[model samples]
Target chain A: MGTVEFAGVSKTFGGKTVVQALAEVDLRIGEGEFVALLGPSGCGKSTLLNILAGFEQLTSGSVRFDSRAISNPGPDRGVVFQEASLLPWLTVWDNVVFGPKVQGVARSIYEPKAEAILKIVGLEGFKKALPVQLSGGMRQRVGIARVLVMEPRALLMDEPFGALDAQTRLSMQQLLLDVWQKLKTTVLFVTHDIDEAILLADRVCVMSARPGRISREIPITLPRPRSIDDLTNPAFIQFKAAIMTEMRGAHGAH
Target chain B: MPLAGQLSSSLLAFILPVSLIAFWQLSGTNGVIFGGALPTPDRVWTAWVNWAFGTPTFGLNPYVGTWLQNVIFSAERVAKGFLVAIATGVPLGIAIGWSRLFAKLVDPTIQWLRPVPITAWLPISIAIFGIRDFGAIFLITLGAFYPIVINATQGARAVDKNWIRAAQMMGASQAATLWRVVLPAAMPSIFTGLRIGLGIGWTAVIVAEMVAVKSGLGYVLWDAYYVGRMDIVLADMVSIGLLGYLSDRLIVALSGWLLTWHRLQSFNQ
Candidate 1:
């Protein structure tokens, strides 16, 4: 169980001709809650996520995870990069075991868990295959599996499925829904896709670009154990329409 | 991928070399070419056979049965020099690439010194090391080191930032990240450096032996040329080419074995 808190977080880049990527953004996620930071390109949603992940530092304010200040990226927060970013040299099994091996966890403890996670991700047969050998969706599955094997307190994903085809994207969405339902870990998902945010997150925070800020927070009250089928639900459509109007309003303000 | 395709591809590669050899054989008259200065292919072959098989005549003929010994001497020098290059160049390259302070301290000096050719270093090398095996080895090492270090630095610098971040997020320590992530990520570039370094190593060894040492194929080539044994000179040149080609093939085979994943990766892409 992990909670996140950010207060008055502001970020500026470049020494000359300063670019304010983020502007005093304040947000929080309760333990085990899934929150999507929804926005358009350059909305600083990814920057916000990066600050939380400790990949980048904020110019002001602070970010805390489970009451601890975030300083360096650690196994407690697993990041799924937009490109899936699996080390191409490692086999799937090697990739899954990398975190445990690096952390010096006992093989007796991690081997079975690694195997179990691979099975959950439907990569049991691809344990020996290199990431290059897998399709984009399969590689992303390995990426998720590799992270899940760490049993992190939070999953920080940056546009994880933004590159997939529509069909593969839906299947991945269902997979994530199933996995999230079981794990109940805190997740901070960043995505520009409206349907993705609506379908995945417990709450959607719509953001504005150019001096990025979260302008609205809309709670998703859709039924649990949701899948892609929920994407077509009348309630989902209504929520999507409301969020679209809110997004347009924020876009105009920007 | 099939047997026939493989054979046809190999045959196509050999066409130019085989044609050139036939042309040389046709142009030569009485086992001589260009006013007896150059030996024909058959004469070069006979000289090589005698160099390999002829018994020593109380050390009068340097070429007699000493072919294997000279080849071994040159090969050993290359091996030692290349190993030294790897030992010093790789770590230094990584250090320069990974750290700003180290790069600032060491990189400028390296760049300033690099343009001075290995051949140009021979006089200083002999003066410092004094006409010995280490001098030859030193020259070879210096020659090989530049390419290896530069390539390794480039490789290390070019590693994807996300891989490092991913490793850190997965709980890798700084040393572990360098070893497991940066090193492997830099491997493709490092291998490129190694191939280039090795080619330079061969060139340096030949030049070193030609001047600073009295053994190896390079020494033999110069010695035979001075004595008007153009046959032995031609044989030694061919021998050097053969050794260089074989050594290169060995590196290629090793690269293939080590980089199986990279091959599959680029193929998939």
Candidate 2:
């Protein structure tokens, strides 16, 4: 039910001088596939995700989700922002159930589901705490839990752990890996971290800035049920080296 | 009694006012100052006490014991006006901030009208609503509207884009997004407007009462001035100042409660 296809998509930002952000991008992901767009800042990686999430519109071409053209964001495709972006006024539980509650889902259906997701994210006891009182890691847990409670078919994350400390990032990555492995939701994760792309995604699409375009598509041939510990595996190291090399090549071209 | 440390912090605040009061008292003799052009604080205090608690007389003096009644009249006018301002200004401001088309259609007119002082509108208000309580309330509402609307617009406009996107992705309709997200997010700024608007409300009510209405503190101040009763005028001025301060304090307290999460976020940062 979760498939994303981008066909000849282009985006541009208008200022005194026009700058092309994305140039004729084409990509496709099958149901339940985890694809990471690996690139540096300003590479239009976030822009592409936003376009697919319907937060931004493409200058030309179309985006499809579940074989249907999508023009606006909906509960079916959940986005996890980099800064967590939990409403400062809301408590953990309120933030977690915001999606379902706003969509007018019955309390009977979402309350139990939200509770379970909070438990999965290890935030059961902290549900009453405001987002401001939470650590960055804990806030991101609420971010993930909120989307999960909506039972989205596709998860779109843009560097969800980029703002966290190194230790917190690793823990979050592990948490994400566990959740994704269990749910098998089609995922589009955007990150500049090469190790993150290799450790978490089934496929990595390397991209470059200045008229942002995909540079390479590498399939990760690693075993399932992966954890952050796999960063030490020889196969994982090989994938990281390849992604780093591709990134350097993209930078050199720029 | 307050704790010693608490008293110490507020001690600094009382210095300037207390010193000024002492100087004024000393500058006066027999509770008359500047040859009775201005009554001393003691005279004003006596007048306030009498006006506040004196029995009503069936004589020529209408303000013999009408202080509390006038106060209630003025306060009720300000309250009604400010409520009307909130009812119209907040939603309009949110619309102006949220949608460019709405702003284009309504904002310029508001900005153009905002510069016309409430005193200038006294005649037009009187013409429309007549010399009754509604005229005073209308002027107050008009006076308070500008600050409330401008502040609310600024608040709604300043909401983080990501928050809107988050709400959109969560399947919130346009109405839900405005009510559930934009309204709450804009609350801090709206409260700012409310405080400023309320200050203007007090000003408008006084102006309206002085010219259009025959009651309230403003009427008494002008009446006392004409009738050689400077004591009541000074007392009325103090009453207005007190009311303004108390009303602002009420808004601040409410904002402190409503925006607790926002306060904590800022504190953490």
The local lDDT score (0 to 100) that residue A238 gets in candidate 1 is 97
Query: lDDT by residue for model 1 over A1-254, one digit each (tens)?
Result: 68999999999998879999999899999999999999999999999999999999999998989999999999999999988888888999999999999999999999999999999999999999988888999999998998999999999999999999999999999999999999999999999999999999999999998899999999999989898999899999999999999999998885
On a 0 to 1 DockQ scale, where is model 1? 0.83
How good is chain A of candidate 2, measured by TM-score?
A: 0.99
Share of true Cα-Cα contacts across chains kept by each model: 0.79, 0.84
Q: Name the runs in model 2 displaced over 4 angstroms.
A: B1-3, B30-33
Give the per-residue Cα lDDT of candidate 2 at B216: 94
Residue A131 lDDT, candidate 2, scale 0-100: 89
lDDT of 1 by residue, B1-269 (tens): 99999999999999999897777776775545566677778888888998998887886777778899999999999999999999999999988888889999999999999999999999999999887999999998999999899988998899899999999999999999999988898888888889999999999999999999989999998999999988899889888888889988988889888888889878776
Interface RMSD of 2: 0.7
Model 2 RMSD in angstroms: 1.6
